[model samples]
Target: MTELLKLSGVHTHIGRYHILQGIDLVVPQGQTTMLLGRNGAGKTTTLRTIMGLWQASKGEISLAGMRIESRATPDIARLGVGYVPESMAVFSDLTVKENLVLAARDGPLDDAQLDWIFGFFPALRRFWLSRAGSLSGGQKQMLSIARAIIEPRKLLLIDEPTKGLAPAIVMALIECLKEIKRKGATILLVEQNFFAARELGDNVLVMDNGTIVHRGEMAALAADVPLQERLLGLSLEAHQ
Candidate 1:
């Protein structure tokens, strides 16, 4: 597969704190690469940096071989990159339809796009006219992801889509993300849910402190309990 996003020797600093240290990563086209790590590993920061939400203090970040390290956040987003933050970032005060309408860049909402989103998240369709603040956590997550894919995008940066969600909801999300991957979406995700990561990830990177320490096939990492214990310091078999 051709590389869609690449970060080479990337570093980020917030005030006096150096968070990312010589980080390097590659996101291939048409694949989901899971970024797994414990808290404070800079997973979220890496995603933010890719979206230009946080500037890289050093090194290179390129999307489809074009340099984007210095571009503004909105400009980077316009270059076919979509981001679904951990916070979900849905318009709580707006109706679901209105929220999606805003996500479509306030243009005419396409019926096909609405249909596509409904396929992944039936709840969104059911509550199209309901206020986004009234939806449950899982529904909000679905809406966040739906908005990110309202239009065709070359890459999607997703962070912790299943956090604090129930088991059934997590399973539903996993299935939905699998479908998204099948439709040729290139995704780089930060997830702590082992099951979701193991299921949706084609490739995996394990981070510790501030840099990635393990890079390999997701299946390989999933099958190796000792390695998981070493890197993640836990059995990658919980929450099943």
Candidate 2:
């Protein structure tokens, strides 16, 4: 598969804290790659840097063979990258349909795009006239992801999607993401949930203390209890 997004020797800092140290990652076209780690392992920072919310202090971020490291957030987003942050940052005052309109303006919204999101997230369609703040955590997450797909994107960066959601809701989100992958949107996901990561990821990169400690196929990592224990410092069975 052709590379859609590449981060080479990337370094980022927030204030006096040096969070990402020589980070490197590749998101191949038509595949879902997971960034796995314990909390505070820089997974969220990596996603933020790729979105240009945090500018890289060193190295390059290439999207479809073009350098985008110095580009502003909106510029980078316009270049076909959509980011769904952990907070599910929906406008509290706006109704769901109104928020969708804003997202449509940011990118082009055709009938097919609206249909696709509504098909994947039926709850979003049901609450189309509801205010964003009135929605549940899972509903907000669905809205956040739906807005990202308002335009056809070359890549999608999702950060901690399963956090603070009920299991049934998380499963629904995972299934929706799987459907998105089947439709050919390359994804780079930052997730701490082992079961969700193992389920959705084709490949996984385990980070510790701002550095990649292990990288391998998801199936292999899922089968290897010792590897999961050593890298994430937790047992997958315990998550069940």
Candidate 3:
């Protein structure tokens, strides 16, 4: 598979503290790569760094063989990189329609695209005119994902999408992501839910102390309970 995104010896700093330390990573075209780590392990920092919200102090970041480490956030987004942060960053004062409208960066929302998105998240359609802050947590999460994919993007960086969602919503999200992958959008997902990770991830990278501690196929990690324990400090089944 062709490499769509790559990071070589990347390092990031916030204030005087080092967040990422000489990290090397890769995401292949049309594949989902799971980033797993405990809290405060720099998983969010990695995604933010890739999105140019936090500049890398050292090393390199490339997308489609184009150097982007020094690019601004808007420039990176213009290169077809969509990001859905863990915070579910929705416009609290805006209606659902307004939110989606803003996310359609290229032009007006396409009818077919809206229909496809509604198929996965019917709530967004139902609450189209409702204020984003008035929606439930699950609904807001759905909207967050909807915004990232409102337009066709080459790659998506999603952080803990299933963090607080219910089981049915999580399953819906998994199916939606599978369809996105089927349509050739590469994804780098940070997820704590082992079930979703096992279902969606082609490969897995475990991070610890701001560095990759393990990298391999998702199936290999799922099948080996002891290895899962060693790397994640818990059984995959426990998270499921």
Candidate 4:
């Protein structure tokens, strides 16, 4: 598979505190890769570093074989990366349609793209007239993802789409993501829900202390109870 992004021995510091410690990973073109680990294990930090939100202190970050470690966030984003943070970054005052319109300003919302998104997230179509703040947690998540689709992106770094959401809503979001994957988007998903990650991911990277400790096919990790307990501090069977 062609490598879309590669991080080699990357390190990041926030003020005096070192966050990413020799992080290394590869995101292959057109695949869904999940980053998994316990809290404070640096999954989010890795994604942020890849997006150039924080400059790496050491090593190289390459996007399609081009060095991007020195680039600014906007410049890096312009290179075809989109980020959907865990906070769901929706404009509270704007209506759902308004938020999507803002995201669609750079280019017209292509009929095919709009049709695809609306099909994946029919709920978004229903709430188009509602203020973003008025939507439920799940509905806001739908809006957040829909906005990302408005921008033409080659790589998407998504953070915890299932966090704090109800089970039914989480399932719906997962199906939407599956549809996104089907449409040829490469996704680096940061998620805490082991079951959901196992279901949606093609590949898995386990991080601890800001570095990748293990990586392999998703089913391999899913079947390893001991590994899950050691890294994630939970039993996979229970999550299932």
Best by lDDT: 3
User: Each candidate: what lDDT?
Assistant: 0.90, 0.87, 0.95, 0.86
What's the C-alpha lDDT at position 183 in model 1?
A: 85
* Residue 163 alpha-carbon offset, candidate 4, angstroms: 0.9
Candidate 1, after superposition: displacement of residue 78 in Å? Answer: 0.5
TM-score of each: 0.96, 0.94, 0.99, 0.93
lDDT of 2 by residue, 1-240 (tens): 688988899999899999999888778899999988888999999999989999999999999999999999999888888899999989988988888888875544577778877876788889989999999988999899888877778899999888888898788888988988898999999877777988899988888888788887888988999988988788766654
Q: List the residue pairs that clash in candidate 4.
A: none
Candidates ranked, most accurate by lDDT first: 3, 1, 2, 4
Give lDDT tens digits, candidate 3, residues 1-240. 899999999999999999999989999999999999877889999999999999999999999999999999999999999999999999999999999999998999999999999999999999999999999999999999999999999999999999889999999999999999999999999998989999999999999999999999998998999999888889877876
lDDT of 1 at 51: 95
Q: List model 4 lDDT by residue over 1-240, tens digit each.
A: 999989999999989989899988999988899998878998888888888888899999999999999999889878888889898989989998888888775766677777778876788888878899999887888889888877677899999988888888778778877877777888999887766888899999989888888999988889888988887788655554
Model 4: what TM-score? Answer: 0.93
- Cα RMSD to native, each candidate? 1.4, 1.6, 0.7, 1.6
Which model, 3 or 4, shows the larger TM-score?
A: 3
Error of 1 at 47 (Å): 0.4
Ranking by TM-score: 3, 1, 2, 4
Task: State candidate 2's TM-score.
Answer: 0.94
